[model samples]
Target: MSGIVIVGAGECGVRAAFALREHGYKGSVALLSEEMHLPYERPPLSKQCLPAHKPIRPKADYQQAGIELCLRTRIEALDLAGHRLLGRDGSSRIYDKLLLATGARARLFPGMEGAATLRTFDDACRIFERLRAGARLAIIGGGFIGLELAAAARAMDVQVTVIEAASRLMARGVPAEIAAIVEARHRAEGVDLRLGMQVAALVAGGVEIADGSTVAADIVVAGTGATPNTELAEKAGLAVGNGIMVDSRFRTSAPDVFAAGDCCSMPYRGDWLRLESWRVAQEQGAHAAAAMLGAVGEWTTVPWFWSDQYDLGLQVAGWAAAEAKTTIRHLSDDAAVAFQHDDEGRLICAAGVGRGNRVAKDIRLAEMLILREARPPADQLADPTFNLKSLLKAA
Candidate 1:
């Protein structure tokens, strides 16, 4: 039947399917997944110890919602002109409206095809199985994925050696001040951190560094980053840049076709931003579903993300540009929050690192302030005794 078809079954695709029903759309909805198993949560794969694969929604839930869930279905061709999806098995599906939520694939290092990369539940399972106590684990790339896995490996008594090409961890978005706290915590947990080192290639025992040195390891994993899965969209002749280009309303260049999540890049404040966060995927999916059903609005939610390593929790809201003016608020010993404001003193971004969600409340309030464009005084933001909620009230 020709109806709404979501071309992926990740968080964005699954959320879009349910959101269509929730928004009172009395139409057929089909969620297609190339995976053999049901849609599962991916965030916990690196955080929890041998975490049980938790499905985003039980099977019965989809049946009750009248959403057809297709597993092991790979769409090989997209006939955008004809509005049809061609499957590998000579099967075809017609859709009146389509959502491309293919997500992204792990970026692999050249000549290291055997090295593990965590993108699927099966990948996580294999990595965890190999991470036994006393095993020497070598992780290349000190980004969020590599660092989080390092923390998990250390907790299991495994020796982890993190090799980062950059001078510090999480250099992409996190400020150096916050990255220092994360680095200190990792070191305290007995993690061997090798900074400012470029990986030459994979050697017999472990990885070879550019300095003609090698780190011995039982297993090697690459956590460089991810490349968006834009092959299907590109083959279909969609405008593809860093990702599938979409507007603020999640509308692609083609009519009746939408994309969201890591697979798509939408416009922000005078720029195009493609975020790879769980919250963004969830929010974008719901917002795109509403937009598909004639909702007239733009997806202007403030970008935010969080990470957990050992006992420390880090949360960041908005873009914390390195060149932006920063104000610090001391929460406690070894814990503090940083706020970035523009030249006009408008709150642009906030980042906080503390023990176990201690910075969550303030960071959330800061997100609201950013959304409201509240320009509280720098002195007020720097004072820990000053409640951030008061700024919201005053605004």
Candidate 2:
């Protein structure tokens, strides 16, 4: 049948299907997934949903929306000329328009039999079950995933040890000053933090460091980042970089075929940037669907991501310039917000951490200032007495 065929029924696929309907497209939508479960969220895989699984949308909901759920279906290859997708089981289907949202996969350590990586519901369940009381959990790659899993493990009374190759936690995502706060918080909660270390081998007990130290872990988990699933796109002869390259309108190199989510890199700041974030995936999916419907729209939302570890919550809005000047505003002993400004003192990004709603107001204000490209004096930004909301009046 000739209709819209969406491969990989994750957040991007599901959102794109609904977005098509929203954009007034009355056509058949087929959502295909290699996994058997319904479309779901991935961020919760390392957090609360690990203990209790939650479906993204009910089966009945999909039916009501006229979205055909093709479970356990794998598209082995694509025939661009014929608009046919060859399946692994020898099944074939034609599409009027195709949306590739294959997403990404965990970058695993080769020959590591005991270590596990969290990317799907099944992976999360297995990790949760293995995190028993007094169990030694060793996590490699001190990124957000590793640190978040460490928090979850510690909550279950498991002895947590985080081994990061970098000098600080979440080196790529957070600033050095913010990294120190995260390290301090995790350490205070009894997490064994190993920084500036490399895993030479994964033994039975745990991973062996290059420095000849072995971390004793009954269960070893690696959060060593992910790689985009762009093989199918590449086989179809689409231009691929870090991900499938798309224009500001989310169109791939081929005609009648588009890409989105983690698998596709959209235009950002004069270059192509792929964001593996839930929020970005959803937005791009919707925007891509809209573009497929002949709507003129660009994916230009400010990148936002957050992490909740223990009682502290960290939220970041906008992109952080590498050489930006940073200023800190402390609200209390357990709460503070950091702002990064460009050379011209324009607000580029802001990060905040606190127990509850202490940072909420600042986070909202920062997001607004970033969108407005507001430039405030470094002295005013660092002064706790200076009202951040006052900028809105002149904004």
Candidate 3:
């Protein structure tokens, strides 16, 4: 049976089914996910949903998809050479094509017996139980996940301390200058930020620091990094880098087999970037489905990502050139925009915080600029005389 099988129920797997049907791919589709519950959104697990004791999923979203869901089942192994998969029940099924959308898991608080993570539904429940007011919370990483949790814990009147091995917050995502703003804001909220502090060991009691200072806490969390669930493909001898390598078409090393979302590293232009963002997952899932449906297309959408924290909504669009002499404009006390250009003086990235619709406008423009022309820096672009609508059209 020329059926398609998806090995996960996460955004990538579910969205691929939706996109396939929406684009007129009617082959048999089945999704195998280990989680017994419906696919829930993970973005808010660290913020709104976790603190409110709410499920991150909305029921209405998936009820109409009519996608076959196999819950409470884990994939035991993948026999790529035979074009089949072995499930937890020792059952095997042959497939004409397959997609692996296995997402990442939480970076655990290593060696801590009672250490908790906020990745899955179970993790959320486990972590929330320890969020009582006056309870001490020790976070091992100061990235977005850790900082967002810090914000939530602070709002709940809990004592939160984030130990970052790096000097800046979200060092991987945000520029150093941008990270400084967040650091200052977190300090104002009374979040204990041990910058440049390394956690030497995780014990049943608490974390042991390199400086010999022990951080005692009821809950210990790690937001250090997420390792992608790519064991099946790797064991099958598929090429793997930071993730399973795939072309713009989303096909991996094995023909009749594909990968998407965070599990797949895809090429964009000349760059081989692996984005772990939700938007990327949705877009790539659709592309993979399209390819299965005999649609020839490249996944070359401008990258867009957003993060919502306490009174701060950060949105990034396109790629920011680090060395590009750029301009910045403070749109308001709580809002700002930056225009990044290349050495040849062409705009490459349009980034903003708060009032980020400007970046969105550029994205929606039909004739996208290749950034070969010189435009005024951010300050001039923010001037009242500069009509955003015209620039949006020009873009």
Candidate 4:
């Protein structure tokens, strides 16, 4: 069976497999997963998959598509010269082309045996068991995953105390204004947010702080961050920097080997950037499949991500620099939209927070402007009376 061998079974790997068939590729496809379960989406793990234990698709679905699903299989060595992949259990497979969709893994705290990180479905199940009513949860990060889990715990009637090293929540992703809004929302939802705090050590009951303070919690979870799974690529002598370095076509330095998703970093805006969003992963996967079929085109889609907390929805499209000129538009007393532009006045990113429908509309307009790199006056953008939909016509 020599065709395409995808090294991972995450969203990117699964999408690549389906995309190959869609693109009229008659070659065989094998999706290898180190886990026993079928390929599943990770976003639901922090949102609803824990409460509702379900698989994204049944095993029969893959079989019907003529894709081989190799479960609980690990590719220990990559013989790039021979186009062969050696497995740990003395199994080997030859691939005409290889796609490295090996996604990232959660960062675990040292000596924190009881603390868990939500990366896999199994991890979500364990975390769900611990999130009982009246149970105290101490989260040790303020990123999206940590805050989302906090909201989920609060919904379950579990007391949550978030310990963040940064002064604001999601400092790396959201701007100051958005972070303030999110922090306020969490506080109103009865989430005890401990900002500018560091966990010196994790004890049985809770965690010890840097200032000789201790918070008692029934369970502790760390959502610090994720590290790219690039060990296999590095071992195969591929160009590894921050992640497996790939070009705009998802082609790696090694011939006939392509990488996508969180495992690969591509050149963007004169810098190497690795996006961990599910949408980007799927898009890159499809693009990679097209490139593998000799239909190469540089990926040019704008990146966007969304989060749901309590009753509010937040959406951001494209990248916003810290020094970028910003404009704000208010849809209501509590709901607002914002746009960021570079010094040259080109729209770089847009963010909105509001009810589902309103935010979705605003985000769509902003995404259009970003895709076009449109430069509109800051005042005109901030005016709520202005019709943002008109930008699409102008573009």
Candidate 5:
């Protein structure tokens, strides 16, 4: 009998597989993965002080759920019209409904094919093996992955240098005010920061800067961001843009096929957004599973993500534009939350940073406020004593 099939076997795919059962579909569920290992958590790869691999769920869980877990399976082509997936091993899997949660791959630096990138558990193991104390490591990019790696390496007593083409760290989404605090923490931890510097090439022993100076390193890692794994979707003649395009329900251009997580882009607040957050992947997986089960509703989960560097914890909810009006709430000397409001005074985004989950409660509340379209007063947001929970009730 044909059943539901999910591709990729990352957080999204695994979550959707379980969600399908939770939502009472009760049909056969099969999860296919290109990797040989069990579906593992990808976030801890960059932050763990020691080499560790954590599976999303144990092997017994899938067996108990009667979900067919197939690893080292690669789908070469998609026969969308036939509702079939052509495998690389001369096999085929027919599905009543298919989910493409293929996730994303790391963007490598030009001519740096040999440089290490932390995307998979195997990749993390290789990097960790080389991260001995006093070893010099140079990371290309100042984004979350790079910074998190720097922090982890520092904890291991490894020397770290972060190289960024942009003028500031996390230039893509994080605000400058919060970025400055992160920069300060990294500096205090003895990380050598090279901002606004272009990489000329990957030299024999280090990275060559645009100015002809080579940053010496025993190990080089590229945290240059990720690109969606949408080749299969594109080949199947589905709508493709920055990622596989889907509607509110995650339905692809073709029938009986859907997508979610980093592999797909959906409409958000007037434009299409492709988010790479772990929380987004999990939430979208459940949402898409319900969609596959004939549920109809808009995917309105707010875009949220968090990062850890040393003792600092940073979280951001919703989309913060550069021109949005901002208000700051000082939680402590080293902790603060920034709220961004649109012209109509509606809460659009919120960001917070503090020591060890200090700002987690506030950021979570701000996320709820954004979802409710709350136009909380600026003074209330700025005042530390004003309980954010009250704002949620008012909304």
Candidate 6:
């Protein structure tokens, strides 16, 4: 075998290389990255990597893992029919098996230039340079990425106001009540949130809303969300709905070619859907690696994600249909839970804020609910009597 060729050197891409070696695959691993810098951790690209990171050992170890890396190269065209790839610099590459982890790119505001987004290492560096001590930043969107930027800006003592087109903060993912709590925390930290406000335009020094009020700032950061990189797959004529379609084993339309990370769409709950969560990126990458190595496992995984904003930590596990019945629970008067139902009245999703460990337990419940392995009643699931895992094992 000629080894595995991995694309996009981010979290999923790096993990796939490590996973291939960890699973006892004896073959060369090649990674293609367009970034000039070596493959780096992204979570901190928002948190600490800009200024620097606390524990820098992981960054060093990741490179020493025996994976060959090609930096600053672009794979312009993927010839699936011929089972070969063409690069931007006119080089040909072939693989025994391949993984497309091309990842996601930031959605830009069409008319805006000189704007900033926190998607890649370069974006983070640029954003950091503009973050002078007293600079005012206007961030668009109120999702996890946007809120994380708010926390980072607030940490640097910069003035920031987040503009969300949605009615509430993180309304699409978090439960309404939890969203409200997150909103309060951010506001208390002096972050001005313009909810239910659509951005009409991004200017040189401010944001003009659809309502015609202009919010001034020294810099503008847009976190409107991500659009998965699907052009290469689409051009190759793969079954593309929201993303490159894949099966439970992370196998793509072409049997020998697979896709994972943010560019992949797989079965969830039942039908095919695309997810951009961190867990999805990780599990799919590992599963795709296994599938490529001829040792595949069931890839149906409990989707989990967490967001840190101000002093609150929100964790969600499992998929919650937008129309599912939702219940709100309060751990303290300040901390709350938003639980969702999916017609069977089973818990489809749970979002919580203000307590990380508390939310961790409920997340476990949400996972069991998805697997239909939780034997306790719904009341017990919501009970604040004890730790979630303890309760599950106790009862």
Best by lDDT: 5
Number of clashes recorded per candidate: 0, 0, 0, 0, 0, 0
Q: What overall lDDT goes with each candidate model?
A: 0.91, 0.85, 0.74, 0.87, 0.93, 0.78
TM-score of 6: 0.92
Each model's TM-score, in the order given?
0.98, 0.95, 0.88, 0.96, 0.98, 0.92
In angstroms, the error of model 2 at 120 is 0.8
Error of 3 at 34 (Å): 1.0
User: Relative to the unseen true structure, what is the C-alpha lDDT of residue 362 in candidate 1, on a scale of 0 to 100?
Assistant: 94
lDDT per residue (tens digit) for residues 247-323 in model 3: 87899999989999988877765777777788878888888999877786777677666676677766666665557
Clashes of 5: 0
Error of 3 at 295 (Å): 1.9
Q: Against the correct fold, how does model 3 do in TM-score? A: 0.88
Query: Which stretches of model 1 miss by more than 4 angstroms?
Result: none
**Residues 1-395 of candidate 6: C-alpha lDDT, one tens digit per residue:** 25688988877887788889888987788888888776766777776525443321255565677677788989888888777778989997877788999998988766445568888767888888888678999999999898989888898889999999888988778777788888888888899999999888887679888998999999898998888898888888777777788988888888588889888888876788677776677777777888888788768677778887655678887765667777666688667667777666656677777655656666666677656634435565566774556544633
lDDT of 4 by residue, 202-280 (tens): 8868999888899899989999988999999999999999899999999999999999999999998677888888888
Window of ten residues with lowest summed lDDT in model 5: 107-116
Ordered list by lDDT, greatest first: 5, 1, 4, 2, 6, 3
lDDT of 4: 0.87
Clashing pairs in 6: none
Please identify model 3 stretches exceeding 4 Å from their true place.
49-66, 108-114, 320-326, 355-385, 392-395
RMSD of each: 1.1, 1.8, 3.3, 1.5, 1.1, 2.5
Query: Which is the winner by lDDT between candidate 1 and candidate 5?
Result: 5
Model 1 scores what on Cα lDDT? 0.91
